[model samples]
Target: MPVRQLADAVERVAPRDRRVWEGRLPVAGAGGIAVKVSPVRARQLWMVVGMWDRAVRSERLRGRRIRSAAALFGRSVLEVFWDLAQAGELRALEPGPGRERALPTATLRIVRDCLGIMAGLVKPADGAVRLPSVEQPEPKATVRAEVLGEVYRGLVDLAGAGPLERDGTALSYEDRTRLLAMVCVVLDAAPRSGELAALRLGDLTAGERAVGLRRRQQKAPPNRAEEIAALAEVRPSSVRAVLWGRRHQVSEAVYQRIAAARAELEPLPEVEWYALRPGTQVALRRWLAVRERLVEPIQGGRSALWVTLVPTKAGPPGVTLRPQGLTQAFARGMTALNWVMAGQYGWEPMPTRMEQLRRAITVSPVPAEVVGK
Candidate 1:
């Protein structure tokens, strides 16, 4: 019989009989009979066959494997049908109460079972044939604006010098700096956590017009540059400078304390220049100066842009803030903001609340003369 006719016959045969026939018959002239295979089926078949070949060569498959040329040809035909079944191209009657329902469906186990049957038909040149492994599904990405706004608000509250009380407790300076740094970087750079965490002190360049951040792309090809907008209001450069100064301040203090106890130590390195807009520069400089007097200088190389000043028993007092740590901080801040806003406003959408807040800030105070009139 011709190869195409035999393949068609195999496809039409009952499941039990088809298996019996597959074990007895051999395939030939597959190249000439390529016209019989549909494009989609052929593609899936090629993938399955390729996987089987790799498994055999890697010795992943042991014992009897598809080695006969005729059997291999017949195996390809079975593969096409198996691929169809796995892809839900074949329908089965799903027994229901009072009636039978026909639907196209294939479970993961069913697909693997069909693959196992196909594997049995082939004799590998070296090892036995093994079933193909399933590929994992990719995770879906989602963005929640309300949660983002809460995190932003938390940072703003922390950055303010005035005591910020949430639930009758004042926030610490350490919490303020960490939250502020995360908000500033994320708002300005709009980079993923990995890319943000990988940023180095040298990667930032502040020009006369704007600041530029140069870092290797985490999700793209090497050498591709990603442009990030610098919001005039956010003042990311200013935040960066403050973080740098805090680290130096902590390190200097530690050195001084050690000197008093035993011997003198080398002076800490100077903080680098971080350019900012005319309006923001003075405020940031003043903040850093005050921070120097109050906070201890940070210890370590301080090469990483993001570092936590809060002392902890887990490790060193000064440690670099990782991507995961930053994410967690942001989440916690968001949850706190949500709780506060929900209580005061009695449940409103975040966007509406933000709009109201914006309007309140932008509203100019009436003059004394206007009020008197």
Candidate 2:
């Protein structure tokens, strides 16, 4: 159903932003530019609004955020409500897999951003509900670099052992090689899950010494109106208000300031070429060989660097593995790694999340020699 239709009867009759239905809601972004959200973000926005609408109709939403959403949008209490209690619980309310697990902080942040956008679409009301802040969990403590080094050593040994023993936890020979390469890449380059998933066979250099990574821009730019409002403290309030109302009227100085700040804050480039460690290059080469064999059966060929090990509902063994699949496989690989180091002394269980591993690597970088070993 169209998001506009999800609104109350009075709201439905009001002049609607057609892009709301198209799922390409234009948000004022940095420098007063009308920033269009990526499709993924648009879908997420639709999902949150849908969820909020359902919660309102069921009277399950009661809290300051919903009240604020209503007041901010100049809508009635019945017309706009979000289940802040449910969201605050840090679990998915929907009855499905992963409903019990606490939602990722990133997911919660996105939900908050989406709700704010929805509120911005409407005229301001008399009252206000400050958009609630997401509850942040304590940062996961990173393990020592020596710990990751030892784990990497174990993984390398496992890969060099030729074929893994057949068991429920055992991965296929092809998958084993692929997992090793993935681990090596993560430890060496620390690509995000999305960036890793988006990798293609062509991303590899001629000699496979490095991988060219293209960052997917799934996130929309920061709200332009909000930034302008903030700048009102430094700039003329009247001019800031004018810029807020007319995004295109934003000054180049404002654009340069925002751009500079963002560049400093987000140091990661949109595209980066990371040189692979010797061990990483070797593992990648091995995976490439195994991957070639796997895709040989397919008529046209596959471009994805990572392919499924076995037939799935999506396709045969050679089909591109989705990001979720890659993550699950990485977890299984971690289990296999634990199995390899079952009785080893001076070793701890490796962190399962890629983020944790990245942090550990950043804190104490394992020497290239340790990685190659």
Candidate 3:
């Protein structure tokens, strides 16, 4: 059963899911918007189970919708599923409890998520698109000022966040250190789980380098890492920024950059056409879903720094978390602050945990020789 689940996870996320459903959104002409459209697997199963938007195309995936999922890159539906379920695409013939049951809810959810993930996997200047009606429009650059502002505000707020305030500030020194250790662990866990970015609260100690920062997210497999790390050979400017960052200082800078980028974004046709909202907004709490308030120290008296990584949705289990040591004292120093908590944590899926760590721990490589230079 364990191996079965692992195999399912792999098959579900295999290249078949990444490839466009050529059977559905077949190529038309050059200069198309989305060179290809996403296909549904058990995807329609989601809509079959629960609520969904009225705008989706249910006709596209129907009887004989899928073939197989083998050699999927160039292979067709004939490979994967013996009878590819049209669960990703379905239309209700009747209200409820009818002989005509649509796709399952889980399938529909999978389709949507897969589409989103593969959307970015497209090749640049992939091709042009032709719609049912209306002439093709010119490709234009989007200026997303609002998007930028939203990202900026969210990061700054997170950075400026206060302690859990469980009992009171006078958190015994032992408690502070324990919290710091948890923070490091949490940061390492975020991105792999599938959220966004994450960081540790810090100031590089004198001549300390090689510290790493990483975060994890939820949508990914536990073993796949989605974290970011500080470049080993970073410029002096970046090192200074880390060394001097205050509570949420790095967040503010990150926000400033995102805000600048958002200003240049605009809702693309299909990208926003069937979207839930013209422009999606990410909640900060969604970013820090894993959290716990422990008045007592989990570790008796070990010398390891931890950051609080709170996974979204199910959060991390208290008993299963473990922290790794970094040779750089600066990262260790930042771990002592307890102000920063990376968005990573969860021992059930160990890979997701490391994915988060990879993001929260940044590896700043100062040539070891550059130090004297």
Candidate 4:
């Protein structure tokens, strides 16, 4: 369906709130209470609805087609979403050579969210579709202790070897240093890819023995008006008290309790600090020296600790490294290590998963000290 048509369908069913049509989609939350969502979510809702609208042939239903989200309440909207998934429309289509792919867990989730909200709008008690259980992704395979030892040794050897000029290929020495530092950190501290990517120059404090990591908040806290709106629905008495207290004095004890509640609701920092092993610290320092020469300080006086070692279409070298970049670097480094091992030691290729690397470190009897806490 055209975007305009989907927008029209959404507008027809959406509440009178201007924001709902303009930017947000109001979907029912846990108890069928409405929660606002981004326009991207709104698009997903209509995508499923459009499939339904096109499939329905009954003149009465087809003419009125999804006139309201309530039209989807007890309907086969979930089935439609699944059908699309099976057809390789909802997500990538990578069926086996002879067989169709099974419905993905992620598509299952999308169906549940889209249809569930529609159900909630009509039936508060049963707001969403009761979906079949989704299969969880299998955990990364653990590298054997001997294999891990060899892999670590290979990486250390490669890092110390500096840039390779084999096959007349020009490799970035800075990138190799960065990947070594990242692998060392991952083996010792096991920070999430995002945390590692977001590390800044200032995050490495205490002489780089310890690193502080702050995870940016993904969801914004409710604004004052939103809080009041929620209180009106869930805690009417408290809302009333707050409203009354604005014009009149409340007891000191009551005031203190309210203050405590407000403080408890306030967002807390998502910051963490991890102690680095001596080896990990040394790797980081080496990378920092390479980074300092490759990247000059801008007017802001500081930048991301890890940066692109090579130019990209987006820009020249020195752009801040994202989580994807870190993953790619690890993959490339592992591939190079495999080539070296295969040529020299005649060993089979080892697992190159970063998750498995971290897991291997975690499950070892004498695991590398990756965390202080």
Candidate 5:
């Protein structure tokens, strides 16, 4: 839908907002009707916010063994310990009231590894761990799906916030590519990032109409890589799914808009900020925003409360941004944040390497937003 059209619709409904209905989105859609987001959706939205932060922290460190070998592996002390604490928090959230802990196979890998890292005295040369056995299955997969939706919301918010880079600097083409590569590391190392990352351009670009994606580990035993069953198709300028048990398709134009938002993301100094170090909270602080889709930060599973969009075949999503301009200011935020919080929380000051990753394992309730709390 065009911005003007969307805006007009929102305006028409604005006056009718008096404790609207709360429920899940309908499985099927009519040609042109819009519906109020359900209560289940609102909860899911907040859960995603919380999950996004958790995934980011799990990537570069382990829980128990964080300190044993971090200075050696090149990650900072701060990053390592935070991962460990992050893991503990998730494990505790395994079964809770109003909280969830299930995640995809890839997310399972991240959470478990942090525990392994925290357990060992000497660094285990093989960096791996078995997934924790869970009594229930619902939380595991639901959280991951939630994150993909959040990624979409985040992209849209970022686009609207405009470019977020530093000034007087032009990234060499290679530098720009490298920068995006780094920014995605936070996303890639995240819970479902592995599944999303597993997407070979071939996998993403595979089908002629809608691309096909398979839900990998859901029904499979350990070591069984499930066949691709999830399907995504590329329409004229949009992507949709006519096969996921029901109708699911966004406009050709919306897809283009999302793709553009992602392209514009790389130019921001946030690309550099994320690229420079590996901290989930740091990234969240840098990019988390109050937007249409946000319910609460790390609320449960999905990173964004709404959708997840990416680049496609015909034309890369085109965007214009200026993030490089904020480099120093971001660095200062990093430093001040470290100064006030780390030591106060028992973390070592200004950790400088990657292996210093195994510290705390916390599922500390990530508030919905900077303002939401």
Candidate 6:
């Protein structure tokens, strides 16, 4: 039946519920006329209206101090229903003469949400009502361990090599810089991706003892401080030191020569840096060098630590790297590392690089001087 005729039928039989279905048709016919709604659509609409009416009446019957149950239902249950519909889980039943259709996914979701909402609203003495939700299955422990191991190995490689050449293609100066900065930040501060993305050049204050990171926490309290020790054993040609050394210059001939030389040399075996060690300092220095050269530091306005080197016709020179972009970059680096590792050594079911590193660290004895102290 046409929507107008259905509206009329609903008005005659359930005038109070007419407004519930008003202007809610998903589609309209030609000339902006109300289209004929499926029998399933009509049924679902009426069922919701009926449910709403019952909820309202129940609130009055209970004489609760709070607002009407219908109001609560609209706020919670109705919203959940719309969410399910938008997710494409709600579909109209097939038009048939006499066929019992299974309950739609939307209907089930609505019912589930409504029951949970109503359970809280209704008195416990009313009945033995229980709301059961299936827990989502977690990823396998081995799989999770493997992923973390890959990420750990990738980070170590990045720290050592500064953005590596993948498939005979070297990353742009800007990309290499960004990856270097990300790895250094992660190693030194262990900040969330958002926090890392939020960092600015000004936020990094170099004191006599350490390089301090002063940034507002995205998920926690404001004004957290993280430090990279000044005396920390970093590579002399560290990314941090390089960045600091060539802060003003657009291009550094020395750094480029060094980078080129490193690229030509045999790749170093990936090594883990413990605490405030040489590896961390080297990564930090290298990252700083690249960031200084590539990123145009604009004070106050879009002064993000990581910015885009290339600008489009629509935008400015320094575009801040968003958290999402940072995450994608990290994932890409991990994938590249994994691919390289796979090529070098076939899947032979050996302990992860991380596990091996841990074993090595465990077996190594402390220095006599440090132990005595």
Top-scoring candidate (TM-score): 2
Candidate 4 lDDT, 1-373, residue by residue in tens? 3323434545545534655465545554422234675555666666655545544433334443454444444445445545555455543335678765555566666755565454544544534344434566777677765665577677778887757655544446776788788987776656667777888987776567877766433322234324643533434344344432221234445445544454456454465566777877888999988887667643321478888877776455677887787887887787777767786663558665676776666511121244332
N/CA/C clash count, model 5 = 85
Q: Write down the worst ten-residue block by lDDT for model 1.
A: 220-229
lDDT of 2 by residue, 1-373 (tens): 2234334421322224654545534665433456665556656766666565555445443443443344434334423333443344422354476454445577777776665556555535323335546686788987688787786788887777666554666676776788889988888777778778889988777677777777443332234334533544334443343433322344656655644544445343455677777888889999989888888998533999988888888878888888888998888877777777878898788767776776666412333333231
lDDT tens digits, residue span 1-373, model 6:
1223333444433334456545433332221223443444456445544544443344232343335332333344445434443343343334365644444444565555434423333324233333334234442233232343444455566445545576665555456546655654454445556556666655443421123343322111211101111222233334233332221122355445434443454432222112334544555566666655544454422556676555634255466766666676666554555555664542323232222222222212223233231
Clashing pairs in 2: 28-224, 68-129
RMSD of each: 24.2, 8.3, 19.3, 10.8, 26.5, 22.8
- Give me the displacement of residue 272 in model 4, in angstroms: 2.6
Superposed on all Cα atoms, model 4 deviates from the true structure by an RMSD in Å of: 10.8
Residue 218, candidate 6: how far off, in angstroms? 9.2
Residue 6, model 4: Cα distance from true site in angstroms: 7.6
TM-score-wise, the better of 5 and 6 is 6
Looking at model 1, residue 220 earns an lDDT score of 22
**Tens digit of lDDT per residue, candidate 1, span 124-188?**
43333334445544433333545455545544654664544666544455555555554444443
- Measured on C-alpha atoms, candidate 6 has an lDDT of 0.43
Off by over 4 Å in 4: 1-64, 73-75, 90-126, 165-170, 215-269, 297-301, 343-348, 363-373
lDDT of all predictions, in order shown?
Answer: 0.39, 0.62, 0.28, 0.59, 0.30, 0.43
Give me the displacement of residue 334 in model 4, in angstroms: 0.9
Ranking by TM-score: 2, 4, 6, 1, 3, 5
Which one wins by lDDT: 1 or 6? 6
For the record, the alpha-carbon RMSD of candidate 6 to the native fold, in angstroms, is 22.8
- For 1-373, candidate 5 gives per-residue lDDT tens digits of 1223322322232323445433223221222223433343333333433442353345553242432222322335334433443445534266556644444455554433333222221235343323243233332112233333343233333333423344443232222222233233323332122232232222211111111222332223211111111112233222112111112255455444434443443221211111112332233223323211232332322332111111223222221111222233223322432433443433333322111211111112122231121
Give the TM-scores of the predictions, in the order they appear.
Answer: 0.35, 0.69, 0.23, 0.62, 0.18, 0.39
lDDT winner between 5 and 6, please give it.
Answer: 6
Better of 3 and 6 by TM-score: 6
Runs of candidate 2 exceeding 4 Å displacement: 1-35, 60-107, 123-129, 162-167, 216-269, 299-301, 363-373
Error of 3 at 25 (Å): 30
Relative to the true structure, candidate 1 reaches a TM of 0.35
Q: 1-373 in candidate 3: lDDT tens per residue?
A: 2223323433433324445323333321111122332234334323322222221112322333322221121123212221223332224444365443444544433543443222223312332211011233443333232332332233334334544343232333333334333333323222222112122212112222212233211111221111111222333333233322211224545534433332344322210001111111122122222222321244421221233333323233222223232222223333322233344331121122323234433322233233332
